[model samples]
Target: MCVHGSNNNPDIGQLLEGLPTNWGKWGPDDEVGALNYLQAEQVLRGIAAVRQGRTFTLQIPIGHEKGEPLFPGRRPSMRMNVLDKGHYLAGKAHFDGNVEFSDDVIFMHVQGSTQYDALGHVWYDDKLWNGYDAMSTIGSMARASIVPIAERGVAGRAVLVDMARHRGKAVLDKGETFTHHDLLAAARAQGTAIEPRDILIIRTGWIGSFYEREAAEFYSDFVEPGLTFSRELVEWFHAMEIPNLVTDTMGNEVTVDPRSGVMIPLHAALMRNLGVAFAEVAQLDALAEDCARDGQWQFLYTAAPLKIVGGTGAPVNPLVIK
Candidate 1:
């Protein structure tokens, strides 16, 4: 694997010092992390926010003929044919009945497409969310896996903060950064309020650009533009009780921290320390345009990932009902 950070990278522990943690806030055996905030009441809140009957699916299509927007080191999902008319014609396959069937298999990183990351996806100090031992992820994720999230599901009111539109840009420049303050500013500009415990869906237009440009240009020096880590930003998440963060980027936060030169510091500060769930690589162009035209930014955000046992993450098509 192409590990991006260096031996000289600042210690993640020191990088996240002075930030609070939600490790045991739920319970000793807590495994879903911040998804615990998404209770029945949150679902009711989501239903109430549905001002229109319109719906939008936020997942990018997997196995596009051109390519997929993936984390730098990860390959695209590969679809292999199992059986088809061609196989029967070649006399290489047969069915029990007087019929021919087709089957196929896929090889992919659970996180290769738009997906929800496990709370234990990244860790430090030899621990995962809720103080689970990092060793539990040795063979397959035993604790804090995506199973809990997929089984529980995520349903809540969501606000899409379109940073690209707010900045008057079609797409934010590579390696660009934003903070919670920027989120609030953009929400204000959009005339929307970010309520407590709302599913936060942010759009930088990074993932959407994959279709418009060549893969070489898209992945060159690929540092995704997104949320930047800070003590204040982490504190804002804690105070707001933001349950799930959805975004149009591989890593929710900027790929590298400018202040610390650490790769994805928010993966530790927010996902690990604050227990915030991450849903990354969403396609939000359609949703953003709709919200922009209608001036209604809040919606009922609901997603259920494939319930794969021992999966670190699972593909999902998040639906925004407005």
Candidate 2:
């Protein structure tokens, strides 16, 4: 009989009973709810293993897409200036000049390029993550405006799912959207199975075209080449309870929905709804090649964003150590 309860739904019990006899069983008293005694024991064991410091880190660099200039119908260009003040020896004495440093310049604003977007960076309708209003949450501060991501330093076993190798191509089409099935297929192709709490690093091979100014052109209204995660994919990540999702692309998702002409929905679903921090604009071309040759997807990930207080996002230099 199927018993329905809001707090303790007995329907779960009936569902478990329908499983094959060889399947494990759990009692209400001996076991904690649906998790059987053996399953719970395994969970505790896994927790202990994680506490023992068995993990790797991958560093992903934020590309030069953000520093590019935006001119109508002009190819994007990067403009960075360095100011150095030194001493000149004059009359057997060193004379120091006035110190000055400036990188104050305007260029094309690549919203997702090498950026860790604050919770206020994007909002769903009117509500930001954790029910914080976008406008209210963002102000003069840059880094601290969002949650303390860098403070904790996301650490975990990173799995690089190389989609480019699976497709035998360098870049996925600008408007292509990646579904849950596509991700699974890519993983299977690489012979790497994604586990729970694993930092999923997706390499779409888009960073190669980043330096190709002509091919990687930015349109005022049109979409660009990148992978868009489907709704199912977001749910899968949540169910798996992964620590974070890192990708090598501008937005980590296709810019436009091929059918609906809308922008990335996965960003909202993953970052806002699931509280999943996304590491975007990752430079993964070289890392992908190494992983493909070595047949290993693990890497030590390290990324430290500028400590810009009360800011929306900060420039980051993420690196990967094998």
Candidate 3:
């Protein structure tokens, strides 16, 4: 028999029965005092006992023609082809040598698509997370570059929060945003629970429609659905103590912010403050469908970023194993 929390027959009483007797009376300003008062260890152990086991994986291709405009007018990629090459040895006998042949040489210059941002990629107003300056963190002549992240590949248990299914679609459409409540509701609907040390992979299904258009039409505009994380959401993830986050969009945040005039507070808070890692431009359509059909949501997630020396960001091929 499986022991779990259910939306229909929710154990509401059991869920809140352990609340501290003095919950309402506890002072909000007392940080250390609060820690001394709560049963933190016991609560954590209880949560650990009920997690389910299931597997699903998502794949994100790094070089999509539809992603060209992500850099806004920059050439998407370039390739140099080597037509032919021949090598001859001097000490040869039937005219004396064997001819060495080489085929076409190709180099990929990547532009749009999902990528991993190095710690050195962005600085907070001028100060980097670990005290490295922008100049020291990136290359001077070559542009913003950081050490390769492929050397340290990302491997973790993944949890999927299907925002698109909750909204009744394969695509979330441009300009739609997901809230923290939507995430919790989706997990509840899927019969799974999130835990610490997990890699949270949110699927908004924005990338699914990329291939519907012609190559030129797809590359003309770069727009996709994304999630909007509130400060509350950030705090929740921090409290959950997850190692990283991956999402099926270019960046995790929604494209526009009405108040800040900037689009990425979640990135600022997660990367700059919490030091959490993130994978962007994920492909989640297939994975979302699988989870919807099976009602299972965990997966073994793996991703390897390109090993570009001192690169700000590098393309990745992320895979999920069941």
Please name the candidate that would achieve the greatest TM-score relative to the true structure: 1
Model 3 spans with C-alpha error above 4 angstroms? 1-73, 84-111, 138-148, 214-223
Candidate closer to the true structure by lDDT (higher is better), 1 or 2? 1
Model 2 residue 174 CA deviation (Å) reads 1.6
lDDT of 1 at 110: 90
The full ranking of all candidates by lDDT, starting with the best, is 1, 3, 2
lDDT, residue 178, candidate 2: 70
Candidates' RMSD to native = 1.3, 12.2, 12.8
Q: lDDT of all predictions, in order shown?
A: 0.91, 0.53, 0.56
When summed lDDT is taken over every stretch of 10 residues in candidate 2, the lowest stretch is 28-37
Error of 3 at 183 (Å): 1.1
**Mind giving the per-residue lDDT tens digits that candidate 3 earns over 1-322?**
1222234442322322332222122242211111221134423433343244443344444345554324334345444434333223332222336445534543343324567776545445554433345566543413223233456566656678988887788677766777767887888888987766666888877666565656565445344456564556667766776656788776677754323334455555555445556677677788777777867577666677777765666777776654
lDDT of 2: 0.53
In terms of lDDT, the best-performing candidate is: 1
TM-score per model over all chains = 0.97, 0.67, 0.69
Tens-place lDDT digits, model 1, residues 1-322? 4656877878999988889899889889887878888889998998998987999998898889877888877988999888888999998987788788899999998999999998989998999988899999999999999898898999988999999999999999999999999999999999998989999999999999999999999988888899998889999999999999999999999999988889889999889988899999999999999999999999899999999888889999998899
Q: Which scores higher on TM-score, 1 or 2?
A: 1
